[model samples]
Target chain A: MEKIISLHNQHVKDWKKLLTRKQRKKTGTYLLDGWHLINEALTANVNVKSLIITSDQLEEHDDIVTRDFPIYEVTDEIMRAITDTVTPQGIAAEVELPTDQFDIPESSRGAWLFLDQVQDPGNIGTMVRTADAAGFTGVVAGSKTADLYSPKVVRSMQGSQFHLTLRHGNLDEWIELFKKQHFPIYGTQLNPEAKNFRDVAPAGSFALVMGNEGNGLSDNILSQTTSNLYIPMNGRAESLNVAVSAGILMFQLNQNIK
Target chain B: MEKIISLHNQHVKDWKKLLTRKQRKKTGTYLLDGWHLINEALTANVNVKSLIITSDQLEEHDDIVTRDFPIYEVTDEIMRAITDTVTPQGIAAEVELPTDQFDIPESSRGAWLFLDQVQDPGNIGTMVRTADAAGFTGVVAGSKTADLYSPKVVRSMQGSQFHLTLRHGNLDEWIELFKKQHFPIYGTQLNPEAKNFRDVAPAGSFALVMGNEGNGLSDNILSQTTSNLYIPMNGRAESLNVAVSAGILMFQLNQNIK
Candidate 1:
């Protein structure tokens, strides 16, 4: 088997660059750390460019090592140099980014989630994971949302990204498209005029917009919604965590349709 | 106002000790950092043992400084020493811990949430926050769960802890108490025999058990549940994040009561 023992090797240098968003975007590839994520990528048939495993981990991951992809065994030090996590898992994979632009369906028939300027990587990932669990058709991350492939997001997502259609686009455009198709677009806000979420009947198709952690939906987005909804808070917490609020709405809406 | 510039002062030393769980328990006090938490403590009428603010923050927080409690002005260096965050928020307070033992009410007409061995501080805090939003009467943290007063948990809770009753106790004892009271106890697990969560009608009063992030509820605890419930997963992801799942259940059950 091929071995890479030096941090200065070209392959090592390229893999290390995956830690930055700019580098990831430029190369159209990103790193997946730990056995769970790498295994998920393989199971989902994601385009894995290569596999890098520490010499000690190769025997345990022999099945992956035997795959047709280029497998390089590296020392622990070399493995640590290329991974972003504090505790390197001794295994990593370079997978091609899914850059396809998703088109709005001619007839909207399933739930879709849109995130607007949600900055926290963990929150973004959790929202996507919940959307998938609720059987949402896809997710559209607006500009300024955390990069979908960031390591923190990948870890929190638990491989749910592989199970659903996730793409980046202008949220306003998507809202307009859904509106034109007669799909109800519900924007979550805390406005006094907003109706309680329970009051809204779940339809076979709709779009839900969740906003930034500190701010509710942007005014422009809120103005375009079929109606704004609020989760009734019966206690003193100023608001629910964005991810938790999203999960509640998704699952509750899904139950009525099912 | 007393000005403390020396980190070696006895008062500063004692306050610094609140950083550890042992010290927090011994003194029956814990640290509340940042203006938001300090404000929450005051608004909730919690016992404020003392206040510490950097020289610069004194003018902005004059209302709090003018309170009847002992307010100490400290140098930036001294303030940094007592804070656990890297970017110290320039203000903190020492507040008395709520040590009251919560008894399962005789009538048992309000909802209660129980967490078993959920170790992630963020998960614990988020669950508590969700319970508060869902109008849960109280929360009982199993002995093995994360410390309720930990800094990370406090940050994630966003002061929801102040609005509800939270106590640590044995899960087995609490389960038995609820069962005897005839309050249905639902344990979340993915076993084949587990009923879909939607199939069960929400009740006005009940105890919901959420388990550890990794192992779910222990077999012993599972055996005692009135029925094990599962969140139906329509996608490929194996399971939902503990906090997200907890939020879904809390709100769903809450909907029926309202």
Candidate 2:
């Protein structure tokens, strides 16, 4: 066990910076805070550079000491400096930021969820969790979305990232790739040009595209959609939360595909 | 326009208490933050108790405003006193807590979303927004749920509260009432005993019941369910986020019912 008293410890400061995208990209590692996520990484055999625990919790958690990973004990204030949460949870871990390594499985073909510029960290996190649960073949975060390695996204995903393959596909390029492989795209919108989601679900392989929080699908993505879908509503809400909408659409396609 | 410089104003102090549920109910009104929600309330003609604004934003937006409602301009310090947001968006409104005033026409008969003991304010708000878009007749939040008037709920609902009919109902009493009315109760759960959501659509009007964040529906309400529904998931995430599940179920039932 290593004792880290100084807030200026180079490794500690560097790991704290991993909370930001630019830093994570530059360093190729991301910080995971909270016990659940770090535990999942260990269970999955993901490499951990070290464990950082607040001094108060260090006394309470006995199992962490025996782990092969190096352990650093720090004060609560020091932990707060490295964590982004308003109320910092006591545990943190450092791991290599995963790169896209899986091929689009030939046998895995059904509903794909494509996200366009969905920026809210919480929204993206919730969407990842929902996408995993709905059995969508890994969400495609387009150019404008939050970095998947950000601490909030890691926390929001609730370890879903460890379970599925993720790809950073430019929508245009992905659309072309899918089309060449005979997959279609479906999107949600209020345009009269759109079909009700229940009306037009294709067979075999398709991607369900979603847009930004305030804006629906980008015109470029909307234009590329083989079918634009609408979920009928009698109530006065203009739209559903984007992540919630994506969940419904993704689940609907998954249920109907078979 | 009313200009108040003192942070010690009686109304300001009372308004600040709204950050707690007890205070909100005591006053029978709560704060709605952000320009979008404030505008939604005005558009819906929700009774406005007051308009609270920071002096700076009010000064800049003279063109968009300068009229409508009693505007109270307070210092940035004072504005922070009454907000729940981490970063105050500079505008907030006090709205009459909506009651069951709109009569559901006889022609109205379909699925409704009933959240029982859902304590997360953000989930409640998002669920309300989804309920509105899914075209449910109304949403009834029951005991132990977050106060519908909390700033978190209001912001997450994205102004859906004003557009939809929301009222508190005693869970047990409402269950009995729905049973008497012969409205099918679609209770959400992952219990092996539950039926798949797609297999059951209420031939009569239905209510989609969601449970609390940690503990799902209590046994008393579960006993009243005419239809127990589960959103099927394939991944390691055994449960979908409650709001996401409700939205998916609501959309599915909306399609089946129509």
Error of 2 at B24 (Å): 2.4
Clashing pairs in 1: none
The TM-score leader among the candidates is 1
lDDT of each: 0.85, 0.78
Candidate 1 chain A, which ten residues in sequence have the lowest lDDT sum? A100-109
Residue pairs whose backbone atoms clash in candidate 2: A234-B135
After superposing candidate 1, which stretches have Cα over 4 Å from the reference?
A101-109, A256-258, B6-10, B101-109
C-alpha RMSD over true interface residues, each candidate: 1.0, 1.2
TM-score between predicted and true chain B, model 1: 0.93
Residue A155 shift from truth in candidate 2, angstroms = 1.1
Write one digit per residue (lDDT tens) for candidate 1, span B1-258: 688989999999999888888998899888888989988899989999889999889877677655899999998888878886778889989999986733444444578889888999999999998899888888888888878888788888888889888878888888877887788899999765798877776656788899999999988788888988899877667888899999888887776764
